[model samples]
Target: MPHRKLQPGRLVLASHNAGKLREVAALVAPHGMQVVSAGELGLPEPAETENSFLGNAGIKALAAARAAGLPALADDSGFSVAALGGDPGVRTADWAELPGGGRDYTMAMAKVAALAEPHANRRAWFTCALVLAWPDGHTEGFEGKVHGTWVHPPRGERGFGYDPMFVPEGHSQTFGEMDPAEKHRISHRARAFALLAAACLPGAG
Candidate 1:
């Protein structure tokens, strides 16, 4: 069945990642709302100083909501290695000193691998925290995750960053090879957004 549209309004998508922006676009596309990102709005970027994903998501959402004087949506997500004691959990995007701040996805994954033990029992999960903030001070938050194991030799090129290594539970293919539609079906983020859309979209009764 097709998605129902939401009442048209200006909702802010507080994010810097282009992939995230695109994904959110598809989620809200049926809503018939004009969505804009912080980057697109030329708003001052705020630092994510909160202690957790939900905290960080709220910080971003509140900032955008205040700036846009409208409801705002924000998502913060990261991967966790069960063996690593859930490290790189909220710090999925670690910054190394360099031009554009070197992004070391390969090194990060490798580090996670090296940190493992006993045949590299690579159990891991991807987690996403989403927050929706309204100008009236109403806020909603949700979390979703896909449990899976890490692959020795990462495969595929269709996804960004860690997609090549994460094999969702009950499947051998990594997210990098899952394609857009495939990923949406079981994605942690999508599940969370589904709740958000259903509650706020038009004609939800």
Candidate 2:
């Protein structure tokens, strides 16, 4: 099926995460699209019950599109350590869940570091799935990934999530250590957005 082209207008970012909202908004800005987040629109976050990044992204995008009556873009991304047998692939957020509710990524990072301490292989990767959905339920999906080594004693305080521990291949600085603009240029989410832009955004092809 042919991908639907997005007009220069309001686009709903179907995510409640502040970090993700910032990154995605920046990516969409150059395309002349006004970005509004689901949280800003008072839309409740839907449970991500899917087992894969694309599935979860589609769920969020579809729900937001139908509710807001506008095209919605959703991203589901995760950090996976190879030594852990990809244990936290889809449940990356779950790993950060606090007992009393909400999430604490610091604790989550510690858990990951502790678990992988004994293993010599520090290989890990970040995966992102992006989905654009229309009110009528039509959607287009894309995925991107960046492989790197996972470091202990997380460094930097820039990018959110587990970025401080992930040093992308061919780079010494973790995503958290790099300037936001630089990280935006090489991140998994950025890569996925590149595909989406070429396919849907006007003047991008």
Candidate 3:
């Protein structure tokens, strides 16, 4: 099926995460789209019951699209350690959930570090799934990944989640240390957005 083209207009970002909202808003800015986050609109977050990145992204996007009656873009991304057998792939954010209803990424990062300490292989990767959904339930999805080594003690204070620990291949600086523009150039999310842009966004060809 031919992909539907999204015209420049108001688009909803189906996520409550500040970091994701910032990054995604930046990605869509050049395309002449006005971005509004689900949080800003007071849309409730949907449960991510899916087992894969794309699946979860679809859930979020569709929910927001239906609720807001507009096109919605959602991202589901995670950090996976090879030695851990991809233990926290889809449940990446869940790993940071606090008992009192909030997330603490510091604890989450510590858990990842401790679990992988016993293994010599520090190989890791970040995976991102991007989904665009229309109010009528139509959807498109894309996935991307970047592989690198997971470092200890974390690094820069710039990025959120596991960025401080992940060093993309061929680069010495962790995602947390690199400038936002640099990270956006080669990130897993950027790669996925490239695919979506080619397929749907105007002037992206």
Question: Each candidate: what lDDT?
Answer: 0.79, 0.95, 0.94
lDDT per residue as tens, model 2, 1-205: 7888999999999999999999999899989899999999999999999999999999999999999999999999999999999858999999999999999988999999999989999999999999999999999999999999999899999999999999999999999899999999999999999999999998898
Clash counts for all predictions:
1, 0, 0
- Stretches > 4 Å off in candidate 3: none
| Residue range 1-205, candidate 3, lDDT tens digits | 8999999999999999899999999999999999999998999989999899999999999999999999999999999999999867999998999999999888888999999999999999999999999999999999999999998888999989989989999999999999989999999999999999999997896
Cα deviation at 69, candidate 2, in Å, is: 0.3
| Local lDDT at 9 for model 3 | 96
Backbone clash tally (model 3):
0
lDDT tens digits by residue: candidate 1, 1-205: 4432335788889998888888887887777778888899887768989878899999898888888888888999888888778877888877212356767677766666767645455788998888888766667787888899887566888766677879999987898898779898898888778777776666442
Instruction: Give RMSD (Å) of candidate 1 vs. truth.
Output: 3.9
TM-score (C-alpha) between model 1 and the true structure = 0.88
Which residues of candidate 2, in runs, are more than 4 Å off? Answer: none
Q: By the TM-score metric, which is better: model 1 or model 3?
A: 3
Per-model RMSD to reference: 3.9, 0.8, 0.8
- Relative to the true structure, candidate 2 reaches a TM of 0.98
